[model samples]
Target: MKKVVSLLALVMLLNGCDDGNLTQEDINFEDIPTQSCSINNIIYKLKDEESLLLEIPETSFTNEPSTVGEPTLLDINSANRVVYRFYNGTVSATNICETIPPATPIVTDQWSAIAGKIQIFTTAVKTTNATDNSTKITGYNHNIVFKNITFAKNNGTQVYETFPFGDYVTTANALPFLFDQTVEQCSASKQIYNYNSSEALLLDIDPSLIVNSATPLNTPRTGLIGTTVNKLTYRLFSGLLTSGYFCTGTIPSTPTVSEEWVATSGVSNVSGIIEVTTTTLGTGFKHVIVLKNVTMKKGTNDFKLGDSFIYGELLTTN
Candidate 1:
């Protein structure tokens, strides 16, 4: 049965409606306005409203350094400006601090005068240190499963496939990509969807989405590049965005022009057919955060790899 399913998938890949050549629009990255927001001097931009997937060629590593004694002040110098990274197999946070300084540290739940959070040393969670400390490995080595990715309709927004992205090989092989849907949010100005389905996790772009190893241009958009939220790893089972045209719909009669993002992967040479004249446009990317250890309120095949995740991945800059 699974083979039949795989064969069906293969058929879908070969026989799926393939059209629309995406035209490569020359976008000036510098032209996009950069907004800065930071906690503990760890700066991050909400990715401009027009900026779809801002390719972060250098932004990488969100170090939750747990090394001994105060978790060692990770320098926010390198990563403070960008967000996102890519290193499969064992997707890690920022390696701002290349080596663990001497010994491992502990946590107090009291990170500074704040009595609620404590800092710790390098463990399975944090190994490097440089930028900020968010989740001690928010999501890693996870099996991305989407049980109720409710699509709009047969012709309405529909989800084709939802699976896991094993891990980044880090070699020269093309990173398996799912040009599917954005599960998270990049900014408040992003396309707000008034869906009939429930939102388990709000969508937003991953700040630490960019990280470079051999690939000079790190595709940091978690919506495309891939990342974790809290723990579980989420990725496109297929491509990320739909190539179909936008159909007009309305919520409370307000009227919304909606479209679908079909998940298709493994194509670097694919071209666009539509001609976009906008100066600033989003480079359609998906931002998803795989959560952990929660109960599935949905149903069977509702949750995979056990624990439930409450996070979001949005179409943003990579």
Candidate 2:
């Protein structure tokens, strides 16, 4: 009776090893870097004789950060698929990426993800300047994860509670900001601006900053960038910024402001200091505005304008 039971146990163990088409039980490509095809939607990771492929919309990975507790969810379906393929021999990116796959590395086993949700948790990746400790957003990292995924093969299906798909990064949009050194002041409001076509640097100056009095040659009049008084702003517009845009009594609704960054509130002479050197220019006074160690900030990201930055010159006829 003991010999018969031992033979039955050995048979059960051998049957368990034949798990349908799943010879490689562990589908681990965690350390491998994800590669994308020319089609853009297809992303895959290749290991020796195995490959894991994902076909999802490129828009799935948004450049913006995902909200905490609420990750971006995408359902696994016909259009969005996850596939694991085992080949007869070693495979390269050409096997999966090319329109016509090579015939040599033929697929031996295949598992298709039948049901699940692809969860993406995204965060902004920033680069900080060593000189001033200012930060700029370089890219965004999208962390991919699979939840309650079920993979179906020829014989049966295998369910996974959770699976990590690793991180995919996308570069941030570049800020095209270039100035021509020419400054214009608003006749209706206490504002001065230096602008290109779509980018503008504006300063809502204090009344005392641009007085007609001539300042000393070396010692210029200094002030702080405050919330209400000496406010400094950098604006990126969607449309062309005409000369009449700021001169209007009310801020125009057209040529909408896409992005805005404000100067960090000053700490006396340390940062955000507005220095104006007033020199007599014919009948009027030329007030050359220079920003000293100014740091511009938008949310958690910030960048400095170096040690000294010229904010252009403003003229007063008083």
Candidate 3:
């Protein structure tokens, strides 16, 4: 009777070890780089024959950086789903992209994320100008993480305290600034402007800066960019601007401003200084506008105008 009992216990242990469905396999692809499908919403990571996919909403990865202490939180549901797939053969992006899938790699085991919180922490990737000590946002990085997540398998479930999905990077839009050295001043609004069809660079001048008198060769008139006083603004419009667009009594509504960047305020001679060098033209006074160490900011990102940036010449007939 003792021998029979020992034999039965040994057989049960052997049976449990042979059963493949009884235990969960370790699923980790943290070292691999994250990849994306042609579809904007799908992001995945692949390691050998296993793939971890995330079907998230486009809004979750915004172009703008997240607030100081706040991150974008999303719930795992039908719309924002996470899936883990195991394949018989090695897998590549061709297996999951929207384009025609391959025939060989077949999915053998699958796990679906049931309940979880997706957290996206966004920050700007910046490059600094060595000459001006100014920074420009070249791209944004979205770090995706899962918190209190449960992934359900066929027979059991796996829970993770925190799963890092890795970073997704997006490039920033290039500024459309194509000025051809010609500058125009608004007679009614007292605003100097240089514009293409879709974008405009405007400066709200302090009236005293554009006087008809000639400024000394080396000593140019300088003023700091400010809010209500000597302000500089750059705007991108939705539609092409009409001629004399800024001189109107009431700003037009058709070609609305799509984006705007303002010059950063600074001390008198340090940063964001507007230098105006006036010389005597044929009867009129020619004022050459140059921006010195000026930084243009929109939200958390900023770009410098360099140590000495010539902003075109303005002619005033006295």
Considering every candidate listed, which one attains the maximal TM-score? 3
Q: Over the stretch 1-318, how does candidate 3's per-residue lDDT look in tens digits?
A: 999999999999998765343222356665668888766589999988989999987767777788877889899999999998999999989899856688869999998999999999898888877876656678889888888888888877777878888888877776767787779998877889999998889898888889999998799998888986789999889898867578778877869888889999967768888889999999999999998888888786567877888899998898
In the range 166-232, model 1's lDDT, one tens digit per residue, is 1211111112222233342324323222122211122222334422211224322222211222122
Would you estimate the TM-scores of all the predictions? 0.16, 0.78, 0.87
Query: Local distance difference test, per candidate?
Result: 0.24, 0.84, 0.84
TM-score (C-alpha, index-matched) for candidate 3: 0.87
| TM-score for candidate 2 | 0.78
Q: Rank the candidates by TM-score, best first.
A: 3, 2, 1
Once fitted onto the true fold, the runs of candidate 3 whose alpha carbons sit more than 4 angstroms away are: 1-26, 128-136
Local error of candidate 3 at 246, Å? 1.3
Q: What is the number of residue pairs that collide in model 3?
A: 0
**Residue-by-residue lDDT tens digits, candidate 2, 41-122:** 8888898999889999888877667778989999999989999899999999889877887887899989999999999998
